[model samples]
Target chain A: MARADVLPLPQRRAIWRVMARRYAHLPLLAPAVAVSVAVFWACMAVLVVMSVYPFLAAGTPRFTLDAWQRFLVDPFYWGVVGTTLRIGVVVTALSLLIGYPTAYAMSKIRRPGWALACYVVLFAPILVSVVVRTYGWLLLLSQTGAVNYVLRTLGLIGQPIPLIFNTTGIIIAMVHILLPFAVFPILSVVGQLTSDLKEAAMDLGANRWQTFRRVTLPLTLPGVVAAAQIVFTLTISAFVTPFLMGGGKVQILSGLIYRDMEAVNLAFASTVALILLALAMAILAASNVLVRRSYSRAEVLRT
Target chain B: MTLVGADRVEDDVELREVSKRFGPVLAVDRVSLQVRRGEFFSLLGPSGCGKTTTLRIIGGLEYPTAGEVVLRGQVVTDVPPYRRATNMVFQHLALFPHLAVFENIAFGLRLRGLPSDVIARKVDDVLQLVDLPGFGTREIHQLSGGQKQRVAIARALVNEPAVLLLDEPLGALDLKLRLQMQAELKALQHRVGTTFLYVTHDQGEALTMSDRIAVMNQGRIEQVGTSQEIYARPQTRFVAAFIGEANFLEGRIAASAPDGVLVSVDGLQVRVAGDGSLPVGAPVTVSIRPEHVKLGAAAAGAANRWDGRVQDMTFMGAVVRATVALASGIAVVAEIQNDAAVGLAPGDAVVAGWAPQHTVVLAR
Candidate 1:
């Protein structure tokens, strides 16, 4: 009775076959993803080994805490980290403030072609070498350079103030170099926003400022966080701009790492590089969390 | 009681020969129209017909290339939307994603620099008016499409703008939601009695909601009159064909007189009356609505009649449509409702006729 009511063997076999077919894409996907993940984990393992290994001299294989101790105990190393972080934080904040309005103005252009032209101008400096831009800033900010020449002509200053080869020059150079990277992501995010919300708010009796505070600012926050993360991480890791502009007087972690590498202090340099990487990763993670929160909130609003 | 003014100072809108051009495209041609105080007026047209553009010009979102915009008979061409006493409910609704329902509704009041207490009270009153009183705490995403639309209305209305403009506000909704909103919006307009300028491509929406309809085409107003007038006596061929279902008979005028004109299409000749002012031998198109065409008529008050064979019968739940082939071999369709008892089947011989008064005359 049960056999008569049951399905045929071919039908049962076909059902089994369909179940097996569910994972047909697995084999084709296995190699490339597996290899890439393996490569990533392998690289991480090498960095971990180098950081924990002892001995400051390069080309020596030894296990020691000497390098870590030297990094933590030295005030100079701490100063480099502090300066790099300070600059990175300031640059990221300014970029967000400046980026939002530029993006808003760009989005308001009636023609898409003109908007694209604005983007090119905003993004062109990024294509130029950071070293070259830094050199340009170096010449401009020099005591006897164009900056002083202009300032003196305006009678703003009687004597040429210290400008290039200092902390101020390094900050200015770093900002110019990182401004595009900071702006583009935010502009893309803002460009996705429709003017409808702003217009609707204004129509509802909201003033221009109120519309921005209530709608424009909150919606573009995810982009702001993303831009901040990129700017922060990139600024901390920047070696060339600071090296050229800081002129040994203002030292950041990347410059210290460079000096350590040249001195063949491989273990010390590795330790510093590892610390820089970890700090950057932490900042990136925090920024990512902020962005995720805003995005989810936006999703909640959208739904 | 806090007394500001008996009527909100900012509740009026007008456009005087306003024109807007985007490079080569004249989006909204020199369109000049008036919305009476507390009248629900609609600008009706198809896509790219400049209805929305005209509304935007009135809202101060788009500046007219020429002419002036007056609100309450005062020139406000330079006034920004934020400074005007008019609010817009966007086609997309454009509700604030960051704010909850209450905040969105109260945004306008807040912008006027009103005290928080007054804003909260006004928002509450409007939210209740829209039947979403307790749902003020709900986020925009949490609300249904209809609910979002209601909130958008509440936000616009709370500020008590003299004029309220809706730019296809229910266009994004599904059919059921759109119908529900139509009734809701009609009720809302009557309740507030603010000068309302509505833009829509949906003729049904305009007919159902507007006190008056302005039929627009190519940035110019083809006709402006009451919905009934516009529907019944369409001034142009575009209005009749666009506003409702009308079969166009492209023909040449065989005879033209002060009282009437005979239009010959293919081999069938139709006498079009009440058509304004035409010369003899001029080309003209005659338009007749399907329902208005008489089938097997005895006394439909029709002055003209034609004998033809029934070629096809289409069942439309409320009405049955039959196509009749005249001796001239030209087919004309006549619609009779199921309840109207169109008993004739295909291949049956019948006489199709219509009244001269019901017949409208239009140009090519």
Candidate 2:
């Protein structure tokens, strides 16, 4: 855009280099983009094709609506969808209720060393394998496990409660495994909030609870929305924890997909996987709107 | 602490022997002051001088480690900020970023469970008072800096507080805007008629805006008085140095003159107008303003006259400053109106002197 004829050779070269640096991220991102296209999008296309046209039991591949009809017309399959969404909503809500306070307290830690210790305690479980953490949960939540034993010793229950192989076990494990995702996003947003906003609210005659409700909660809603998006989608699509904890009792969408895949029903498995993807995408899109609204409202520009 | 002055109904806010300690540092050290009802008072000091800490103590945001705080003839030392009948316009203006301007101003009223119509009416009234009547629907981030400042002020003033605490609310503005806001705030205070306890490090701002100022230094009140009193008759050396530019001449009392005291500075005797309380030979520092120093023929009737040579001259817009070296080899600056003199350059001989009343003698 500059007058190139008036510039010297080295200056022109420098300008060209600056222009080249503007798009430097394209080459840097090429490898990841290529890998995702080949392994994710390409596989997704193959799965879409397999769901509608399949060679099953030595029959030639043909386009048919059998898998779609079987999935859509069946009430049992619809129940699996219901269970998946119900667990997702319930787990997301409980995680928020528990994670919000934890994140707020963590953000309020004044000392670097203590805050670091809290971060380590909160996130160290994520480094361990999900299967291992779920197994640990099973050990803790079994009928004769430490949880029931503690309840028995406290005289709260006369008999060991049925704590595993049900919806309750799946939910408990899912909340535990997905907690860091919830707390991480919320903490990131809450920590960015300045204390002066709350003080301003109080100085304007709002009491402590009023200050939290009117100022603190609204300003930190973006983080809460992001946390919900993550935890909700993760809870819905999660397989290992629910599978191991539910012990074939809870029939979630992921479990259905795994069952069809194990029975060599490629068409049905592909259909279930696409549905799970669509559910996650829909929730993400909805929360993305929420996040945008919250972000715009809470946009603090320093002058 | 005894709340003996609760019967003094004229005082809007009082800090009696109040102190604040942050960890090991004493941020406010036994500071005691009172804000008269319906007066614009300011605590002026440098950063880290604890002026803000004292303001916060009065607002009930920070409790004093000792002593008591009285507000409108009531001992409110234990009252929290929300329970106290006071509001603060914070330094950064701390407008609620999530709320529209209307909601931001309506926050306190809404918390009190006022009806929606009443709240809306009150918010509109305050917005009109701050000169932003129709800006209720605008978000905070969309407003300019000056608009936000008005919103912050309106938010506090809408509560009709007994005393308004302001912590350098204009510190974020540019110089031109700061001056404009300073005049606007002074006018607003007059119109509202609320007792304001303002804190700032700017002496000029305090002098131009406050009815009285408490000059602070090193976490202590150096002096508190009217602007003219504090400027012309500072009770401490720190106040003398901090308020304005002054030439300090360290000396000892040579003798007590008939109406003042004569101090010997570098073998020259300078007469300073005062009570003559200090005994002879007591060490002191004599401060004289450059503008008060007369030059040329104007020095003929001055009480302390000296013959000096101009060493340097700086031409300011309206005033010219001439650094004059006296016969005793001491340099004193004399500021002259550029229009009042002619042809006085560097290295020229001149008579520099000031009246005895113009010299302030501080005990060393």
Candidate 3:
């Protein structure tokens, strides 16, 4: 309190002042926010409406569980689910096994700009059309292809292995495409770790192998889970890789949906698409739960 | 990496004329120093003064370009950090994120293929020593900052290196925490009685913790002495200015007496007694600590007296400092107790003086 009610102008500290919020300008964003909510509701309504359609025949849509029942009872439909799950699991595991070290190397690279350039080159193939990227793999994994040629030259095999136009080809191509997504998440994760932590461990008494197994691997698990989630979901919903590389030999849920739609069976196609969506969500939900449990455990041990 | 316990007291590590060049810059000039068994030594200086570089050289994190680093009299110039008998606590602490505190502390033991039981025992011992006993199973993120620092110290100390190097270990903590950790660290060092080579730019830290501090400047050590010696009688201007606050007055010897010299500054003579390598008529600078200067109407109470105008007075907690200008136009700062005093306005006349022997003479 002061005689003039001045109060000494209460210390104008740099950190004490709160930044003024932009609430004064909120009216400008009101339309966009409203539109976004409306669009989201519209899409949900459409998905539900399409899911309940009884037939591909036009006119009024009717509610029915016939397509859902068909999907549940058919052994082939369940096999597609199994195949999708298998591919997703294999791709995620392979990415982790191969991607962890790749991400590790990328993070440790002395010349990061040059390493980033290399990463860009490695990531270039992921950006190309899936059909083209799959075809490129097809050309490589084919019987008399470049892979066989190089292997033969190196004396690894007497002849080409039966690889292309099968699940093997589909998996190979899908992994190549999905690897970048996995690698990016993990590389960013590994980048966050200071190499000093590893050095500290080594100085404490850990050797090279133990340091990797104990410190490096566990520290980068969040990146691994994030990468797994992205790669698994992307691989599960992949239609082009299986279409181009599977050559009809590997009829995944996406490909089956495509075929059903081509045969004018919109209801069956939608049903298959819905099941694919559900399976992907289930896998993601399970993986998320696993990650959370491990994360909390890691967190607990850290303290 | 064999310097330990009883053997460490017998000159464990030696750097002989060791120098390092980073590109065109000489990060560490040719400098030779030795670590005695169970002695605590510090390389103290400001940032880029090469104290950390020298510590890194000793740690084998950075190799010397010229001289050899001898460990237990055996040259370890080519040896790596892990192969040396030393562990360093980095400024950042660098605790492993994913590992439990126990596992992080036990990491080194596990690498040597120790049984899990042994590792568990060693980790427990270190945790107990650091006062975070039974905290081995906690996650790194869950630990508070101070606990994390303790974990880092425990992690490094568990290896029982003959020489433990700490690079500004207390830098990350707040002021109060830093002050508390300083005593604990010093006590820990005394208990272990190993050769501790610590690096710090903080003058207070170096003076408080080190048995002998090697004051460094521009990639070279200016002086190595105990804190009392470094503070009471610094050999160089840099050490005097860096260690504590001082008022430097440029002068020249006007007359040489039996046991002192009459220094002429501006137009008046200041009776300064010093034992330094400076000749009569040689340009010199007198460094007098601020606290030694007395202020008031001490017109006849000092060897030298000057009438000065009180320019400003700042009341810092615990101490009050006044800027006074001599009649001959030389300004000197004096610090006094900050308790409520009979104050004078800024333009008031004042007399300031100091005893003869309180001044230190520097040639360059």
Candidate 4:
């Protein structure tokens, strides 16, 4: 190949123009990437550094494994980790079960105005602050709340069910808060699916249920997986909803971090925070693998 | 007139005055037609003329807002598609993306809760029937467009439906592939001996593959006849123009005779052989196919000969289409075989005429 400098003047100028055109998007992307790296990664780095600091040291920073060792040995911290994982899995499952049908209905709305109205209703809770919404759930699930009042008047139950200040309350609130995230991805995927496929299924002697099971459900798996991954990751890292709904009874990993930070045990707080991050990453990685497998299966059908 | 009466139990599919309204749009008007058992029937029309809607109505995918659908001598107007003995091959070939070829073909059988071995055997048989024996393990995406089409047909045929409804199944294929599939589909219908209710906008495909065709226009069947009859004796102005190229001459009945009707078009009298239903001095339209319009010395003994100059000549492969302007300033197109007219050119004086029996008279 000829060297760039040895090329003719006009050729060199043309190559320069082409290079400039190809790489022009870099300048536009630089500011956003730089800011994200500086703010987010720098914070993570500082958290990792501080987690290794000596437990009792004051003036000078000294590295030690005390925080990690203490966190690893404590059964209480293990319980918190287990509880957090349970909540994440349960919330993600419940959200998918509820969100898939809602998204399907939204996708089938033919008129744009009606679809927009349905989307607004589905996302209305998300427009409110998470803390406020959790508090709203708290009121709804209270002993004398509307739900209990209706149930009691109907004589379906003799007493009010214990709906708040436990894992049940936290799960219910978190699922409600994270529903829109799940619905949007599934809705978009369902919307992109051609209507002819459904008609074809019906025409091929499949009843509505059979069509859903054999055709629509399998084709929309990628959307389901994507929604699961998003809801699971978000639920694992969520703080405000758990704090408000758990009511001091459900001691999750995030709650432990909060308590440790309030007691000025910075090293301990950092250690728990890092463990939470690792657990979230583990779930996300597994979900990503599941998504890729399902995606490849879907890609095969597209051909 | 109804093609099939309620007593015609041999008819596989019958639409008796079927009508469908989607909001304010009338998709299918009061259409009545029939498909004889084991016949290859086609619903041919332009887009938005309700051919697909009529196919759907016959398949029981859409219930008629008025009239009845009789499938195999049973009134099935309210029956769902799954319960009806008909399966449709969609235009886009909607193969299930998640399933392999075997599963797609076995879908209907599996829904009926057949044994796994029986489903497998039926799927294999259908695969052989469509000529794709070893494609069971392959995903739908692995198949080419033509292969996908074959799979879709196999998926429907494995059910052993009384009638197989096809909604423009070859509309997506290239011209060469479409022609190949058209021939294969006709042969398949013959081998299976099933009533095939097909839909298409392409007149060539319709004429080539169908034993009989229902020419539809504006949500109504303009005429229903064998391909030869449809081409030779179209009943209405729409069918005459929609099926093939026709040179229309606006006229009125000058006189009625026992042999033929005399129509005067722009002061030129032309004799047309048909049942003289219209009285003298009534408005009418005369349609003549281009191939019947002889040119030059070939027009010597024709009774309705007119001297015209060729305005334009298009050299098609087998024939040359010439646009000739008559002495009355009306343009008539004549498609002459290239072998017969070797050096015909524009601005040449020509006499274009056709036998009086070939002229089709229609109400305006």
Candidate 5:
């Protein structure tokens, strides 16, 4: 007899019920996990194999490290990698400087109608096509565009400045596109903060600046780190904004990938793609350390 | 340049005709009170009664719309909370979750630009004072409820301000922990001798911990006195009802005597202790405590006595509360020791009475 048959019928059913409750979430998680493993992981495996093998000739497959070596040793590719990281860092920093204040102001808005309006304004841009938004930036930031026209009318500039077809245009457009990502995480954390903490700090004889530095900023660092990670990865991996705004002037990693793929250089494109993935993983790992450190104190671990 | 009666060095905090209006609602009406140095003063009221608002006004967290806030003999009505010499233990404690216990207590000192060694020493001292000596390195989330309460108190007390404002810091703890913290807080205040301005809606807490309590209702102070005075001789109906349980009997003054006055409630003349100043035929409400109502032979020789039948009885832990209906059909609850009420049950004949002094008369 089976072990389950040794027990009464009700007891056997109760054991099955306990097991169903234990692993109930597995069924709910099936679709997402299935898609991730099938689409994402399977594609990643193909990308890894493609990066190692330069060409697929008829009968026998030939594998070589020449693409990796050539990409790693080249100064031009390294510069492209550096530019990608630099733009990512600058965009993330600028977004935080602008997003923190916006999130703070939104948190302070008491009227629900006004708050909803603010949210609409902040997130509505996300619904628009990224290409259309980049085109809008192009029209505004061009030499004879509205921005230059306004500056010239105010005599702020004697001549039109080069705003497009460069890193500056890419950054401006990318920051605009990715701003909501930065604000959303920080807004959630800021909204959860009670005013009592600020009051407690002031009551302890700390001024406004001191309180912000010692209490407010430290408590919200996890949100800031999360925003930085999201903005950094999105900025680095961005393709269309950089392709349109850079106008072929800025050669970032993604741009290099696009260039190689356009020339049918599949091996080199796969190498660039893997390098970008590695960079993102490194930054995410660093951010995870920061998030864990900040959360270790803020969250209750056990009784 | 000090105004008369306004600058009192003995008073750690004084509010003169302070009022706070939140839009259409008057959160705190024209309220005035004084908190003496080294005394535990409490503002006791139900929620939305403006006790916390009044405390905040004194702490400089809220500005009074029409009056002066004098702290340590200085008119600081417009002074910001950071500039004022007061610290508050918030209702939720509000300890910084990002910092360890030591850093939390040292926040004020560090802001003052104290030396690192001094800050550390002071933090350690306060940690020990709050009975958490080695908890300096512990994160706030690691603490139990009682420990967190102590940490919050320590964080405020370390500043050594002119006064410490506590806004129901013990409101979140369980009953047993709350009672323990109450005793610990009272003893801590006694040891430190810092003037404390406490706000709580718990009457028992206010009575046990406060040297004086200001009973508030509907944005106004009904009365301010010691626990004994506030409990024994409540000046208003709100106070008599809010502070503790009371039996209210509404009636008209029937007659007056040198000893006391008699208030007739539905033709039942209940004698009350007073100077007989109330005119006869005037309306009044008589307040009596259930414990003061004696039943059975214990009602003998009382100034005001009534023969009644037991209508209902409830068994409390140490006492039995028996509701007695008088011959006139008026019901009054009588509390007796468990042993004394053992033989009593519903439908039993009983005499309910109380002394004249035990009856409090309030004008209706």
Candidate 6:
């Protein structure tokens, strides 16, 4: 066989050209890349540039630490940061608590038609607009809505309980929005688990609950962690659900940034944006470390 | 029904008219079986023959749509798998991947709320019994195939179950390892004295390991007997074809004598013993094992003899198999020892014969 290294220059150049031509679909990705750069990266760059500029600038690009310093030292901004994190943590926990069993049931459904129906139900909210879904929750949680009316008729309480215009409403709405995220990854993992393993667990004298705790739970932990990461990060940066459901009662970081931007205080808005970005990054990094450690632990058992 | 070990009539497990249905398919159809105490009984069949389903029913992992499961004289038809005094060694050796060898074996003990020290001692004892000493800390993925198999068996045996159900546990191993595990499992059953209800499609494994085997076909058992009885006197065509190599000759009963029956196949008369109850002129099939057929010089003084042409000769390591074409156009295979059948060739004319007792007559 003729070695490629020893081939004539012209022949080698021809082969290289042929290999390069094999990737003819490279230009097909141009539109997606262009949109990503033009919209997301450019906006982020502008935000970063405006964040360092001095506050109350009169058409002059003078740079200072005034915006960053004020935001960092403000106790109100700290409360906003804490609220954002609390909402993220609470929503993530609720989603997981509810989603795990739903996904497990979906995975165990043997009939294709029933499983397809479940898939449609899971992704139906995603197909609808987020604003529409939040409005649906708004109607459900309102004082005179069906829930309160039913509770009143049943004489469960004397007065209408506060559900909307508070953290409770935001949490309920966010969990509904993020449940599909939590379910899908866990569902895929659960679907991959063989029936034989479960049967073996039972045959080895482990009851149903013990089998789920020891075998099924541990095996699907990676998926659960992935779902948590997605839900947590998304809830941290969420705007529309909190804005609509909170009804100005819940002061979150994203709402503060939006308020600062609406007032045309670009410097302060950019500063709040940067703080949000940093917090999201920090939380994601911490979770990444936790996920990696857990993965390695699972890997040890596997190997 | 002459039980192989009739001295002890107490049964370890019994299935009475059990039937299981999946959708429209009857997986196990009204099957009844009895496993005596301390006996190694095998449900032997081809794939999809419902042997594994029957074993799973005994393990309580599968519920029979109709009938009862009796364990140690108690009707346990509705008992779940965890509540039963039975554990299974799965076909794939489904050892818990997350737990170490020790924890996997001690899972049942821990569920019973046994003390740590007692659990440890029991796990250690089972590990040693399975010849896996000092392997308690090793994870499942770190073990070899045979080691994993031992762990699976050990995991079940540690519970000290009254009946150990094995669902083709050695089916995943390679040929050499499968043979080795077969002998080890048989020895382990002997030492533990637990009734073993084993299920396998491999005839060789069933024959070598089982004290008695129930030959299953479709969804029902054809016959249940000792390996020798199953091999020598199969009552059904499926059993005769499934258990080993047999050359079947279709015939009718020519005469019934005090000692045996005379079967007329084509134009030839074949004498068969042990089937004298088969009425004369009844249609029957005579099954004869390949090794039982005497060829050429060995056919001298035989009760039934025939002239045949050797069509093909195959040299297996231990035995030489010859495909012989008889005068009536019926073909039969005969296996002879390699040393004695060295000179036989494809075109050679030979006289093939089998003793009257070697022939098994089955009604069509």
For model 6, how does the per-residue alpha-carbon lDDT over B1-364 read when each residue is reduced to its tens digit? 2333443357989899999999998999999988999999999999999999999999998899999988877789898998899999998887777677888898889888999999999998999999999999997788999999999999898888889999998888999998999999999999999999999999999999999999998899999999999998899999999989899999999998668889999999999887478778999999999999989989887898999999999999899999999999988899999987978899999998989988899999
lDDT of 3 by residue, A1-303 (tens): 344353344543322343224355678899988988789556555555676785525876778877778888989888988888888888888877878788888877889788979788779886688878778888898998998899999999997887887878887887788878888888887887777777776666556776677777777788888899898888888888888888888868888888988987777777887777778778789878878865655444334
Instruction: Judging by TM-score against the true structure, name the best candidate.
Output: 2
* Model 1 stretches with alpha carbons more than 4 Å out: A1-53, A56-77, A97-129, A153-155, A207-209, A261-271, A286-295, A299-303, B1-12, B247-287, B297-301, B325-331, B339-343
What is candidate 4's DockQ? 0.64
lDDT of 3 at B172: 81
Give the DockQ (2 decimals) of all models. 0.56, 0.70, 0.33, 0.64, 0.63, 0.55
Give per-residue CA lDDT, model 2, range A31-68, as digits (tens).
99999999999999999989998674457888897998
lDDT of 6 by residue, A1-303 (tens): 369879999999999899889987889989999999999889888888888874435667777878888888989888888899999999999999999999999988999999999999889889999999999999998998888899999999889998899999999999999999999988977877777778878877778998898788887788888899899989989999999999998999889889988988788888888878888788879887877754554555433
Give the higher-lDDT candidate: 2 or 4.
2
Residue A147 CA error for candidate 4 (Å)? 3.4
Q: Write the per-residue lDDT of candidate 1 for residues A14-89, one digit (tens) a residue.
A: 8778978998888999898788778966766666677666452355667877889998999988888999999888
Sort by TM-score, best first: what order?
2, 5, 4, 6, 1, 3
- Tell me each candidate's TM-score: 0.83, 0.94, 0.80, 0.92, 0.94, 0.90
The DockQ for candidate 5, computed on C-alphas, is 0.63
List the candidate 4 regions with Cα displacement exceeding 4 Å.
A1-36, A55-63, A299-303, B1-7, B308-312, B339-349
**C-alpha positional error of residue B31 in candidate 5 after TM-score superposition, expressed in Å:** 1.4
For model 3, residues B279-331, the per-residue Cα lDDT tens digits are 77899888888887887754358787788899989888888888988887789
TM-score of 1: 0.83
- Which of the CAPRI classes, incorrect, acceptable, medium or high, describes model 5? medium
Better of 2 and 5 by DockQ: 2
Off by over 4 Å in 6: A1-49, A55-63, A291-303, B1-9
B1-364 in candidate 4: lDDT tens per residue? 2365555867898889999999999999999998889999999999999999999888877878899998888888888887888998998888888788998898889888999999999999999999999999998888999999999999999999999999999999999999999999999998999899999999999999999999998899999999999999999999899888999999999998678899999988898987899989999999999999989988888978999999999989999898999988888889999976776788988888888889999998
